[model samples]
Target: MTQPIFKDMLVLELASVLAGPSVGQFFAELGARVLKVENAATHGDVTRSWKLKAEPADTDTSAYFCAANWGKASLALNLTEPEQLQQLYTLVAQADVVIASYKPGDAERLQVNYEVLQCINPRLIYGHITGYGPDDARAGYDAVVQAESGFMYLNGDPGGEPLKMPVALMDILTAHQLKEGLLVALLQRERTGQGQLVQVSLLQAAVSALANQATNYLVAGQEPQRMGSEHPNIVPYGSVYTCRCGGKLVLAIGDDRQFRKLCAILGAESIAIDPKYKTNYERVQHRQELNQMLHQLIAQQDRGPLLQQLHAQHVPVGAVYTIPEVFAQPQARQLLLQHPGSKPGLRQVAFRLQGQQELDLSPPPTYDNYLS
Candidate 1:
């Protein structure tokens, strides 16, 4: 088979934590030559020891570090040194893309901003991932960005204070947006023969990811609420119960037709046609009552059988899966999501070769190897 795209693209990754490196990893998977640039004295990336405490050299064993640094080469240098800075400039001259996830003022202070790099390579696609906007000086983390961007307000339980999403969603979203911005910059460079700064902020990404929610609030003056796995305006479109062998199965009914089918399958046709539950709006209003009724009826169902029956009905229903359960799932197996390998000293995740002939699953580099 032919090699994947970007086999010749050289990417310089100067990102830490999630935002910058996540984007670099995606590119690395597509056959880009990605070099993770970090400072020699400091920890290579904050995620190195993000989970459990470990010795300085043991970071390669961290799943947190493995997630972002896979399929890339690591190079450490102290830019404060004139020689190292010149080396980086030389790298920039050769690179097709440069990504940095630094504090707001760090780039300008270091004199490694896009403008400086552009002087070295006019065609370089420079991407910056920040916590806040280019002008904001506030310390931006995922939580802070989520709150500032109005995304936190839409999460969590109803009537509760605004809560941020459980994961580093802002950073992750920013990473993807950075990838998109890089692609756009590449296209623009192709036309104008000039490189440009592509900046993506976590706050901006959070707002962008809100999609229809943001529009609805702006147009209808309806502050989005925390529905807790339930749709805000759709009824019978949320969680339901089905009884089978001994336990209950949660069913999700998205439309009136699906609800009608569910009712038929459960032999509860009256509930589907009842005037109080006839319309989607009416069903939404009486969600509590409906849930209660379905919960009672579904208490005797087995989860396995309910899932099979629902799949046959073509209803978009599913049981909530745990993290480990998802990895063990048959569909996940088909996708080849699991990486199997050993780190030199400690075990680390191997990058799965997605129908590709070559696999780059080397463990995070050591201090000496990182500096090279």
Candidate 2:
């Protein structure tokens, strides 16, 4: 295994849940000495118990916690205690980076705000991750941020009620942004020899990730709606057909040529030759009729042959895969997404380093009980 990237860098992580811990996880994976500070009485991060009911045991075997907390050292400390606070301060005085996820005023109340810590060590890169922001008093949550950032509006059926994604997308996006901020601050410190405060808000991250949807609204003055797995400007850009094997295919045709090829592959070249479906605009306008025609032909067909045919035709298509199918699938397995490990067994995830391969570190620390 290659050496860790931040092998000599010290990171003080006070973040809990996803956003803050995710940043720490990236740094730790890159060889940073990440010290995760948590309070024992409060049961540390609540994610340690957020397992689904079907999981073996709910106690401390939390997938959510383990997903973001891997590759870091845990130090349970009560900030309310003077001795613990002193030790934390000592850590802060030596740390190159400090990540916190407290609410607007909570950091100040706990005396972990950037200003307080910067006084102790002027070179400390302090990162603040919040829901709405430290500016607005609006409370933050995945669902709330999803709604506020217009993410909920673009998901789900066109006429149906807007909905947030199943996962905490905002937190994950904010974590990525926090990682970028940390890297930029590290680079800046290299030049100025001074550290600065970095901020990442869930709302800002969500809005930024809206991409073309936000641009459409701003430039075209269009109110985007949930299209129910359909593309706004492209025909055949959604679910193609349900297979006999219970699989499904989603097809996206970038231009009229691909659409023509798709029709030819389906043995329906007459549809492409028709004047009404000659252009992309016309095809998009007649998407429902085209989808109905394709669905009728592909309904009983198996996915394997259909995918093979589509690949031969150079059509952009994919089989809809379940989460379990994703890991067991060929491409995912080839990417080394699943790493072999002992204790709990197989761990699946991508690595942080650009060229480094995945390494199975020791099993999760038994923080509640001392490590054996």
Give the lowest summed-lDDT range of ten residues in model 2.
337-346
Q: Global lDDT of each model? A: 0.75, 0.80
- For residues 267-357, could you state the per-residue lDDT of candidate 2 as single tens digits? 8899998887878889878878888888877776788998999899899999987877887886666543233452332232354457665
Q: Tens digits of per-residue lDDT for model 1 on 144-188?
A: 888878778777677887887877888888887888899888888
Instruction: Give per-model TM-scores.
Output: 0.89, 0.91
The runs of at least 3 residues in candidate 1 whose Cα sits more than 4 Å from the true structure, single-residue gaps closed, are: 53-57, 160-162, 238-250, 334-340, 343-360
* Candidate 1 TM-score, true structure as reference: 0.89
Give the poorly placed runs of model 2, Cα more than 4 Å off: 56-58, 334-357, 369-372
Residue 178's lDDT within candidate 2 is 90
